[model samples]
Target: MYVIIVYDIKVERVNKVKSFLRQHLFWIQNSVFEGEVSRSEFQKIKNGLLDIIDEEEDSIIIYPFEFFSEVERTVLGVEKSPIDEIL
Candidate 1:
């Protein structure tokens, strides 16, 4: 099954994390990254990530959702939807 992994990380460290994944991963997107792999590969990716990230300098929160509904349920106001939407 396809899954969506959403991450919220520090602004400065975002680019470094994105760049690292782009080398070993496909389907890269803004803040959200998606790809398909075996269970073993998935575990390896997680471990590889931890090795490079510096906890004092940056932090990453990752969540794997089985369905789009779960993602939609957490939606905040859209950025372009309105000027006052976030206010």
Candidate 2:
């Protein structure tokens, strides 16, 4: 499945979280990542993030795409074309 993972974490642990996510997803924007991951891989990624985030202060959101073509997007400044590999 295609996934977009966004995180809001304490500043002190932000970089660590980004690094951890980079292993599983493409860093699309600050604190935002997107890519394709298998169900098993997604579970692992969630488990890994659970280990690093502070429940009281950190939050992570995962959006799964059943079909990339079904998504409608709009961009203004710094437009980044959709990654071909993702299609």
Candidate 3:
């Protein structure tokens, strides 16, 4: 599945979350990531994030799609291509 993960975390732990997500997704913007991940991989990512995030002070939003083609993306400025495939 294709996934878009956005997060707003406390400044102190922001880098921790950012780095964690980078391992599983492509960084497209400040707090936005998009890429493809398998079900198991997604679950692992979620579990990892849960361990690192402070639920009361941070927010993470994940949007999953059945197919990448189903998403309509628009880039007005510099275009950062999403990862074509997960290795």
What TM-score, over all chains together, does every model reach?
A: 0.51, 0.86, 0.87
Cα RMSD, each candidate: 7.5, 2.0, 2.3
- What candidate 2 gets wrong by more than 4 Å, as runs, is 80-87
lDDT of 2 by residue, 1-87 (tens): 888888899999898899999898887777888887888998999999999999899999989987666556676688454555455
Off by over 4 Å in 1: 56-59, 65-87
* TM match of model 3 to true structure: 0.87
lDDT of each: 0.56, 0.83, 0.87
Higher-scoring candidate on TM-score, 2 or 3: 3
Q: For model 2, what is the alpha-carbon lDDT of residue 4?
A: 84
Worst 10 residues of 2 by lDDT: 78-87
Which of the two candidates, 2 or 3, achieves a greater lDDT against the reference? 3
Residue range 1-87, candidate 3, lDDT tens digits: 989999999999999998999898888888999888899999999999999999999999999998898888777877665444432
What TM-score does candidate 2 reach? 0.86
Give the per-residue lDDT digits (tens) of candidate 1, residues 7-46.
5567766777677666545533466655544667667767
Candidate No. with top TM-score = 3
